[model samples]
Target: MLKTLGFAIICLLLFGRCAQQVSPTGGKKDSIPPNLIQSIPLNKTLNFKENRVELFFDEYVVVDNITQKLVITPEADNPYSYRLNGTSIVLNFKKQFQDSTTYTLNFGDAIKDFAERNPAKNLKLVFSTGSSLDSGRVYGMVKDVQTNKPLFDALVGLYNPTDTLNPAKQKPFYFSRTDSSGVFSIENVQTRNYTMIAIDDKNRNMLFNAKDERIGFLSKPISAGVDSVSYNILMALSDNTPLKVQRTLPKVNNYTVVFSKPIEKVKVTFMNKDSLPYMIENGEQIKFFNVQPHSDTTLVKLSVTDSLETSTEFDQKIAFQAPRGKERQKDQFTISSRPENNRPLANSFSYRLIFNKPVQTIEDSKIELITDSLTHETLKNFKSTWNETHNELTIEGKSFAKDTIKWEIPKGSVISVEGDTLARTLIKHPVLNEEDFGILRGKVIGADTSKLYKHFIIELMDDQYKVIDRQYSSPYNFIHIPQGKYFLRLILDLNDNKRWDTGQVNKGIQPEPIIYLPEKTLIKSNFELNDINITLPKAP
Candidate 1:
């Protein structure tokens, strides 16, 4: 008390009259919250009759977003309104005070200064209209159940089963939002057995009607007594609603259908062997293409099944018609390079040319290397390979010369299916030296490629948990790591999709297993750390 009072005195001395003017820093930031100078009706007053109240502070104070941070309980039909008067808050109650009951005004982090804006801490002022004030108090924390991480600003409420009801429709008897650490408390609560609820109110309507709103609750009623009752609530996203077709868009030879949630097992049927666009199971979108429109219109159906195969949800067959009017311009087939243009390349590196459309021809005789507008060295012998889709072109050579070499593709050297010639282009490739990289070689033990789980991923991450590289092969070896400290995480690829799958609560399945190796490794120039085996963590 003395230290805060002294700080107030210093603040007053630094800037006069509530410090409305700017004050120079005293080489230290004022972390002390706004100190209460005085209050009307005083705190803990028994048989208090005054309805109007005023709280004076040592500095200019402002309260913003009071509806979210302020709570008055047991609640009144009409809320109190307040105004900032210089360094004071003058509050006028709208309803008459109840007799023999304790009323609490919890000012949670809403009151701050005009300058530094340092908030006043959890300030609760309690008073009684009758003989004595209620002594009961309740405190607890709220968090996400799956991630086990703290959630701040979550609404925590206590309700009497007899008098109060759904928090979705009305306010509870007492409520408060979680602090920065996910902790909340309501002091001077009435002594009673009450049902508790916590909600991540997304819309700030003080309700839980939205589909994305999270809900948590105490398993049973909490009985408040003279001492505080502490409890915790784990929030979870409700999955009671079944997946339904949210919308569908039909185009030429394709149907873009989206569901409310991710569906693992889905069956799509149509006359044409339509191809759904590649989307992870976690995404809600899927597209069907590679179709031949025999008629002007078509109908397609999509059915989704749950993991247990107990029930199947189906979407109404959507009808699509051929588009009318002018045709859209076709996208020109373009070429892109790898060990990319103007990039440093090693002598033994393989070059690649990726085309948006399949290339009809690559005139090998017209491709050559150049330097300073003069003809340069050419590949003595090279191996070329193309994918089945003809969209990729890979060229492997024996070795590249040391000079900063230039590659040239003469006009008409390459042609697309439309018979359009590729414009001549040039690229510069510089040889990469030895100091640019380090090697990472490690081993992953206890991997089983059985029916249940076929593959595991060993990922190298920086200190921030961002994955730098991931290897799915045995022995878990990675080369050419930049100089830095790295951590390792092993993921049990349950579905052999080569990615960790998130849990689906409705389907009753947990996420794919992931084990983070406990140790961090540092790699330097020309360093090789071998025999490091990272074992999977045992599930609890």
Candidate 2:
């Protein structure tokens, strides 16, 4: 009996220990690995011929995804030519000599073992095919020209200047990723003329598609030879192609243009009596097409033709210049209502106002609500809150009885941290009707509830699911919004950085994770004006 009791106690204790060890609540500790020691031919070597290259590390390291991670410059004819056996990486050239040619192979996040995934970090092997590697190299940092901050993971490439060599037809002779510092370096380049282009590779394909991507180029060709070159590359937006009319909605005074890129200079015009184009006012990027029927129908031709002069001409081709990627500013302010679709006949629904830029202060006097076709009155008992993630201002008040409301943001009412004032009459006449506007509201729960995210964003979408409204909030806070279907998402404002960041290939840092609310939240017309709420998941 005594022996059995002792054995039973031991088993119970062991089981308890095992349960504790395997429990998900018992946090597992992450391991750290050794750093890279050295590499042969040195990084950024210029001019010379050699059949083999080697890299030496301090510890018994292993190569991670060398195949996917290695990027050879001046890309060789035979690309699959490198071998990573253990601590060393070997490269065998398949083709014979090209005189005085410079080559660079960037081992991006590929020099780590299977154990910890610790990266060797920016390990590069550079050599020359001729007696001398080109001594000239260009060094500089890439950034959003407007923001003046380093743009991480921005692919910076060097191209030989030739009108025939477009980004789509050719690959860069040499390339490097912008480091966290937004700095990039291309070395061992021969004495010749080249152009620097930086692209935000939204598609992940190295090629730059002007229609879908953002590109920055030096207006002039750069000459490189004996000296190491340095240049600061400011990426600007480009309008490479004309706007494409996606769909036309003659019913509403609005149509959709699927731009090849985001354009700032958009102008729409109607043909005058002399067949000359007259500008349609208030055109902006993305949502540029407005149909509010300027003047009478008799003044303009209903079936206008393009320069092509096709017989059935309801379409007009407008030349537009897209703003540089760096200069594209996100439109922050959004207006939404609850019960997104099929709003009730009653005017009791609430209205939600969202902003994309951070608001330092909001003057209530500048906000006025007009109801019932012209009863302009100050919203009574209005309350406002600032959301840092969406950079929004949430204003709430008693419900109204009408389905349509004219929301006005007066000049000098909204201010930023820098005290930069919004345009006088920024939103002079924003009309929210039952057919288009909707509200989205949600709560943000952090991975560690005790740890609070600085801010959260809620975005509302139109019928085509484009973001039309947005709201920012604090964790666990509830916001009442308009009646419309919306795709709800949240961003943890970790560094207080206003922008989302992509992962770095060299540093092995994955892009910051954005948490999206599961399923599209729908606000129906019958929903209690104050009863709609949404909850956001935590970032993994």
TM-score of each model, in listed order? 0.57, 0.45
Steric clash pairs (candidate 1): none
User: Model 1, residue 528: what's the lDDT?
Assistant: 74
How accurate locally, in lDDT, is each candidate? Answer: 0.69, 0.54
What is model 2's C-alpha RMSD? 20.0
Question: Listing every candidate in turn, what is its Cα RMSD in Å to the true structure after a full C-alpha superposition?
Answer: 11.2, 20.0
Q: Per-residue lDDT of 419-481 in model 1, one digit per residue for the tens?
A: 567778777877665576677776766554344445788888887667778889668776667
TM-score of candidate 2 to 2 decimals: 0.45
The segments of candidate 1 whose C-alpha lies over 4 angstroms from its true place after superposition are 1-33, 39-54, 71-78, 83-87, 90-105, 114-118, 126-267, 271-292, 303-328, 332-435, 442-457, 472-475, 491-498, 504-521, 531-539
